[model samples]
Target: MDKNKNHVSIWCIVSLTSIPLIMTLGNSMLIPVLPILEDKVGITSFQSSMIITSYSVAAIFLIPVAGYLSDRFGRKVVILPSLILALIGGLIAGFASWKMDDPYTMIIIGRIIQGIGAAGAMPIVLPLVGDLYQDDDEKISSTLGIIETSNTFGKVLSPILGSVFAAILWFLPFFSISALSLISIALIFFFVKVPKDKDEPLKFKQFIRNTKEVFKDEGRWLYTVFLNGVLVMLILFSMLFFLSENLEKVHDIKGIKKGFVLAIPLLLLCISSYISGRKIKGDLSRIKKIIVVSLIAMSISIVFVGYTSKKLILLLIVTSIVGIAIGALLPALDTIITDNIRKELRGTVSSFYSSARFIGVAAGPPIMSLVMKNYLNISYITAGILGLILLLFVFKFIKVDEIGKSKEPA
Candidate 1:
């Protein structure tokens, strides 16, 4: 850690933290509102689905480019402008929905634009946190935990917020995206100070070479964490979606009551993330153990859900265990990547990490939809097997020095 670095204020943390929170809310909040969009715009369900698909596809493709840009320029430079773009996207969508007789095309366009901005905003944050606390694994891990918690909190809050805003005005959630982005933009502009770049800038070719070399040497564990990010998100979201569907279909839970029930597991994730991050405190061995336990617990509990799912109370108990596992595991994965990667390469590598996570997040629902429509127990087992595969990689390859020296990719 830089001994001379300025003391970080709560505002700086809030500013940075708000990016992911806003990003999550900006996208996920639109899910519940999709039904509303379909009705308001006189659009088919497929057209409304396009509104989400446009944003995610755009973000996934552009994230790597955004990371490199942040690597070339600076984190705040990439973030502030991206926030403005999102703000514009939100306004465009909100306006189209409000005034236009035919607004579907315009709303899709706005979401695509917002997706473009999203590619640059939240994904770079892991590396930015790495830059801010170089060599201080404890702070990086804890702060990353906080950021992850904010993200999970946003997911937990999305349905309720969307419902609340839509109750007043169907188009209000669209504008809410802009409102939140504005707050993030202002907070970042006023408070967040990225560490001054000290390394001589790498030429593009050299940057490519450096990135390739990083994978060549550290691909074993790096890919593990990357895969870790994917599987954790994949399992988490898929289970949550399944749980949501089961609640509404089987138990007749809907509206805010359904939202509150969903919150149970997600809140567990938030709490587990906060506490495990503090406890792990840069201990890679401890991180590994946590990952192993989380994976096993998630697999077992989810499989149990296949049998117990018809019972609402028992189902929540089991899935909440999965939530706790995910909460403890993700910070561990974040620490392994952030603490090990060199600061110069942090943006590029962590961008890949974020892209993997986004893919997992994107795939979860469709995967859940497919699986739940068929033989459900078999699907749960398949998801569990995917987790165990990740566990195998962790046991074999995730070794780091106990003395705090990183095996940086040369």
Candidate 2:
């Protein structure tokens, strides 16, 4: 890539990356405020969780559809409308919280809408980034890393921002989401220019046929990538949900103070993701090596986290270790899946991976809440075991050539 060309691509990449940052802020920002919502809305812990689950559920189902649509239509066409939908969703929730005596139902409805918009916005971003640098695996890996880092950075910001907004007024976070979505919409519209779709858009039937063919040839490694994506997300979100609740309920920490505490592990996650994203550089062996080692480390850390829950400092330390493990694993997963697929199928295949991930995000909080209620150790132990299982699968099945090409499935 020429200097001028690289500069333009970098500018576009920066603008495109904001979609995930804002989407994460919209969703994760509510973690610290969940307790406040329960008190204000007279809802149960599970009900408070639905506030997050509702959004992910919507995204979980719609993300693949959005990915297909982005392939069928165009990236910008899908992205712009999605942002508008998210903005509207935020307004609905914010208005209901401001005005209604019983706002829980309406707020959920808004979150569902927000999730629909989220389905289109962030999931499409992976393939759009892929579209930008068709021949440059290193650039794609690093750009995806930056995008993942932005996403993690939002997690780092969410607690503080959520707590601060909630302290001002319980409903302010919803309004903040709307304002941020609007800003992202403008940024994407004005700056992120994707290349025109050159391949004849496949007919739905033909697209399905091609999709099946791709899976038949690449299903083993592809499925591993999907499952790993889901596991990483589940562990990350569940731990955050658990930690946020623990800090507030057990330690008597709340508001901005609690947010800062939450930020510690997440800051480690963000930095680790950025560094790993740049380092993987599309090397298959390196990617596999990182995934295996990271999962092993994650398993150990999560087990220790469960045992150390009574000690805040120890828990924080263990949680940060888990953060590093997950942060390293995500970009490698992104690269492996993206690099292996043909560009035409990138949007659809990556969307399925993204949707699987949202499933983890959706299931994490409520499940973790239930486990924590009964046996806190169970939550961490289960996550650790799952990490170990993933490690075994990677060792057995995740084979790739020296130049990073996946072997055909038997």
Candidate 3:
């Protein structure tokens, strides 16, 4: 593993990094423009939220499947075709929104296709990173940090870029997915060189058994990671949905101004993720502490936002805190899970983790839409409570001795 690490190139990192960034852009870019979508397609807030949910829901079901495929065939084999699929899906969505009198249904179908592509692409990055540094916890953590930062950086860009694209045309953001995916596909194809699996591929039945056994021993920490994944994304997307809708309806903020407002917290998030990723340095205890503190911080921030006044500035400040909290914990989450599992099971387990995160992303905006229709504070409080529950679970059941052995294979 260390031998492979020496051969790593700048383009390989950039290419691997680009997958999460592009996958994130494909999904998160739509957040800011969703209200515009509602206007263009004559859809309700709920229906607009469905666009995001449909993409994520499709990914949720298929990520574990993709995980196993990458496990068997290889990451690039899975990633290249997935990017092509995403490009096609984006084109379908863009064209449908352009020509169809009622483009909502076709757009949703396009999103589902994109979701399938996403299921194959994003989750596999986790295990591939693990594959690159199987014996070095520090390198794995730091590199994963760069990757996570790229992911958050994409979020930072999404709102502003989405707004700009929407300014050109409501459907233009969808086409931008094709452009971004094309770039990533090219980067990966020409520059990225993933190490081939030398071990004989596990049969599907054996793969399933290994997965179940991973859970049998690592279930506590694994489940904690999965639950936290769901919560983190749900918190993020729900906030993005709220901010987009709230800025427009209540504050009379729209266009680039609104996009910048949405980007503020995410920019902070991107910076924090980079910092946290670098600082943790593969220490298991440190990862645990960050995870615990981040959860507490996020819970408090959400509760504060819920109980406090609705002033725009206050909301942004608290929301930025949430972003920072999320950023602080995510690398820890990635490292804790990826570094613990053996290489053979890494892709499948990571995919399950990605799927959990997708569930939150899929549910967040619609959940917010439903709550906003009645009461907003209820959703925030509920999220805060869930965060606290997770914190307790982590405090008690992480099984650090079993999972956190440094530089040693499980």
RMSD vs true structure, all candidates: 2.6, 2.2, 1.7
- Please report, in order, the local distance difference test score of every candidate based on alpha carbons: 0.81, 0.88, 0.89
Question: What does candidate 1's lDDT look like per residue over 191-300, in tens digits?
Answer: 98887887777899988998887887778888888898888877776676677668777888765667678778888888888888788887878888898998899877
Clashing residue pairs, candidate 2? Answer: none
The list of candidate 1 runs beyond 4 A from truth reads 1-3, 34-52, 100-105, 402-410
Better-scoring candidate (TM-score), 2 or 3: 3
Q: Per-residue error at 403 for model 3, in Å? A: 1.2
In model 3, the runs with Cα more than 4 Å from the true position are: 1-5, 307-309, 404-410
Q: After superposition, how far is residue 279 of candidate 1 from its true place, in Å?
A: 1.3
Winner of 1 and 3 under TM-score: 3
lDDT of 3 by residue, 76-190 (tens): 8998999898999999999999999999999999999999999999889888988876677788899999999999999999999999999988899999999989999999899
Deviation from native of the Cα of residue 254 in model 2, angstroms: 0.8
Specify the poorest-scoring 10-residue window by lDDT in model 1.
401-410
TM-score of model 3 (CA atoms)? 0.97
The CA lDDT at 70 in model 1 is: 93
**Most accurate candidate by lDDT:** 3
Question: What's the lDDT for residue 402 in model 3?
Answer: 67
